[model samples]
Target: MKFYNFMTSQDSSVQLVDQAVLLFTLGEEKEAESLLVEYLSRHENDLSAWRALSEIRLSTKDFSAAEHACRKALSINPDDLTSNVSLARILVSQGDKEGAEEASSKARVLGWKDELAQDEHNG
Candidate 1:
């Protein structure tokens, strides 16, 4: 098993996530996944890390891992629209219509709530 210290400060972890994203965009998904998994090992509450990990798994066609990662994200924040949408996508591809609809509904509700909150803030 690969071992590394996992007590990084939030700012440093965020920077790592950004760097991982750059790696991902450059078609270095293996490296990106390694970095993200490292980040999540300690900062498991990190929303972005979970979302990015889910994306990486999905892109790699690891459907079960993608669903698990997406569900993990949702467990951390049940109202996370991105995670819910991702779960919907994964479920749809797996032929789980009911599961997909539930996740889609969650995303829709979260999206509308966020949009309303933004509108209120702007007004």
Candidate 2:
């Protein structure tokens, strides 16, 4: 596979994932989501891709799908602070305050103290 100087060398180095993020940034949400879904099909264990998928779904108010993606990321790495926080937010949106708090508390304990909103919004 041809390498791009911009894309980091990693197991999840699917050009489609970067393209999806670009599409999303360009306000082409549908195309971005399509690309992400395609990328996920082959790179199911990619934490970054899962996180992006969850964020995109969340933006579209697809709570269930977002939660599923978040859970997928968590399954890959339960200690993923971002996924924990995302799961917390998804749970809160689904009116599961208890679950949300639990997830949030776990994220807190995991030392993910940074504000997630800025990065999440960009995604």
Candidate 3:
């Protein structure tokens, strides 16, 4: 039987996460998520680490994971807009208007005006 090569040339999850961030910033969110997931398997519970993963999940419409990642980020920082927006947007997408509104209000009150604007504009 032929053996498959699952090993990546670069084994650094942090590096993969960095690449994911760059890709996401460039509007390649789906591709970023693909890379981030691999990184998350190697490094769990890292704030920046989770933030990147959460963003990837959010961009790819994986609301559940996005929420989870946002919660994880909140666990690290109660006022993390990056993750909050991700979670709030996911809630909005899932038709949880109340939840989304609540999150949006919190974000607005918590100095996340940018997030609030994005939500309002999209909503």
Candidate 4:
């Protein structure tokens, strides 16, 4: 895994996320989660951190927490395709088929929009 240069004069929030990613890669999920929680406490509007937290919770089978984190990320940016997909997975794990389908559809539409935007930019 690629590690960020912590010695560089980067933003503290970025450094914190880099550390959390390192911990997560080392299989120190609880430590990573704690770091992410700390980061979120200071940066509640950070969508990427919310998404990472959601993924960690999902890996731990904490479906409700995963959904909550996913929702938080979605609230920050409702058009985020990855968060919508994560929400779908979390809902599916919790046996909420309808919610999962809705999330899935949202993700699909977002993906299509992204592709169209890319095509427009390239073509």
Task: Give the best candidate by lDDT.
Answer: 4
Tell me the tens digit of each residue's lDDT in model 3 across 5-27: 77664545556667888998999
Q: Write the candidate numbers in order of decreasing TM-score.
A: 4, 1, 2, 3
Off by over 4 Å in 1: 1-8
Q: Write the per-residue lDDT of candidate 2 for residues 10-30, one digit (tens) a residue.
A: 634556667788888899988
lDDT of 1 by residue, 28-121 (tens): 9999999999878888888888888899889888889989888898899998888999999999988899999998998999999999999999
lDDT by residue for model 4 (1-123), tens: 998766743376677777887888899999999999987987899888899899999998988888999999999999999999999999999999999999999999999999999999999
Shift in Å, residue 18, candidate 4: 2.7
TM-score of each: 0.87, 0.78, 0.63, 0.88
lDDT against true structure, model 2: 0.85
- Per-residue lDDT of 106 in model 4: 95
Clashing pairs in 4: none
Candidate 3 backbone clash number: 0
Candidate 1 residue-pair clash tally: 0
Collision pairs in model 3: none
Rank the models by lDDT, top first.
4, 1, 2, 3
Clashing pairs in 2: none
